[model samples]
Target: SAGRPMTAINSSYYAATAYRSDRMPNQPPSAERSWIRRFAKFRLPWGLTQEVALDDFLIRRKPSSLRFQEEMNKEREEKQKLGTYIPAPYEHVNFHDRHDHESFRFSLWSKRSHFWIYLTGGGRGLFYIAFVVSMMTYFLMLFALDDPWLTTTVELLPILATWIFLPLFCWALGALVIRYLPHLWVKPSRGPIWEINRRTGLVTLFDYDNNGEYKKNGTIGELTAPFYEFDAYIATIPDRQGLVTNVLYIAHRYRDIVINFRPLFAPGEGQLCCALWDFLQNYMDTSRPLPDLPRYEQYRHLDPTTAEYDRKTRRNPRFWIDMNDATFEQELYAMRGKIDQIDTFQRPNLMARHVEYVD
Candidate 1:
């Protein structure tokens, strides 16, 4: 059942794998073909990799893992030296405590909406094309017309209005009408699509079917599982062109629910996804402080664990929000380099004690 107590889960058949390691076992591409139909066209980052069984790896949450701890410590020291670090500007696509101060909701809805808009060719693509064509037509008219500059500009106005402005206006008007019409009649999402509630230790996923016509149905669309019941996996799915895409996903041990993690981290390489998995574990574990990322610095005081951790360590609350943009960007570059050098496979699987295995 959904949202069952974590203690009720006694075992799993999958072997736990280190989150940082990209070494995946070779398995059949067709292992997940049944469910793959729904996500066949998901435009995730692609690279070459060996195809593996979808369920082959169970990535455990290991906040205490040595490499995770070391990298976090390094980040802390570097940021402190860079001056008071300020949290980056808030974005709708990532984690936020807006729903509940003690909880963090991770969202991909904005990105999903954008994807649909662009897929239909009615987003920036339409506006950009309209602007470019209008400019070219204006220049062409100036060269061909015999009138003086002002007269030519005046004469071109009607032509531009008929050939460009009116059509562009119609397209923009249609897009807004289409986008806003549903909201006028249909109810919006009942809750955030993905959320990790630190106070309750529950992870929620509001799953929506493929159709973009309607919002998620009531209780049938919701799935809430204990954070401990979730395991991360880096799925190496090959597309029709034979290019493999490495994407991160979180799945319930005993439920049919799976959350696509690509929109959050937007990992281009498999290793970045591993790092994000490490950070996510740290974020969810109430026993530990929040991962010292620029994004979470502002919310440190809201989470009990993080507040206490900051107090004990005498951490500056505005560690990220106060830094200059130039310095922050430099540190980001340095951090990326450090992340690339991280040894993902060296740490032993720390979920050994928490997860029971069945023969």
Candidate 2:
């Protein structure tokens, strides 16, 4: 599986450092995490450190192969024919467009807060409905029925005050609590918890203690490693009902750092996760053109290798931008078929040349 060494981008020292072999190990073992540990890890907040072991399941270790490129190119060309071949970078993945071109940042706490809001908000909504129904019933009795027990304006005054003021006060208090309560448990992160930088070929993770407190002074919690120095894995976890959940994780080959962007992809998208792994390799490999997704279309020229490739091939600058929804859906359905046909494990690990492996 030995191949030509990576050529440094613009002969720059920083870019050259990404290709260093000293930090990588020869052979990484397949260490399956226990179901109990997986369950506990899933419950942990995102900013807290989740390190990897050498024995963790290893999926990808190097740049993608020609076969992988051919499959992706085939999908891109199919979309290009439909005029819906736009850049669908990480930012656009899972229908979220919050990320910038230089990096894709993800935070689990933000997602957790949203989950809590949905739950607590539902209960508050029921309370509002009950109050409305009760008020309607009370008014109907006082006006339409003309009941002897509810006759005068003075009697109505106290009843109306009770109905209006009590519900309004409760609703207002509930709203305030729902808005601020989650912040007390998990502090709103100052920035993204995980970031993958396209320009630097580096992946960074910010760590916090179990209590969700920043452990480092002046942002000392930031841990970064070369993109090529990590391996991808699928952590299959089963819930209490015996339903299995597949989570895609990336673990540093030498360091204890590990990160997952589960919120970016929906549950049961294991194949899509595999495709994402291939996309990351293509995007980070300076030797190849960037993945032809709609998000990267505008920034294609910024990457030296991608710019040169587009120039030599005369690739359309608006390939992804000029796409339509209908054709894009058609092409996406077909692309998934291609993705399913691919055997991610069939390809040899090109990391063999990039790192030394031991028995």
Q: CA lDDT, every prediction?
A: 0.52, 0.55
Assess every candidate by TM-score.
0.53, 0.56
lDDT of 2 by residue, 74-131 (tens): 9999999999998743323242123434566676545554555544565467567757
Instruction: Using TM-score, give the best candidate's number.
Output: 2
Which structure among the candidates has the greatest lDDT? 2
Ten residues in sequence with the least summed lDDT for candidate 1: 49-58
Q: What is the TM-score (0 to 1) of candidate 2?
A: 0.56
Model 1 alpha-carbon miss at residue 332, Å? 2.0
Off by over 4 Å in 1: 1-101, 106-123, 126-190, 207-222, 238-242, 265-267, 353-359
Clashes of each: 8, 13
Give per-residue lDDT, candidate 2, residue 84.
Answer: 94
Q: After superposition, how far is residue 301 of candidate 2 from its true place, in Å?
A: 1.7
lDDT of 2 at 118: 49
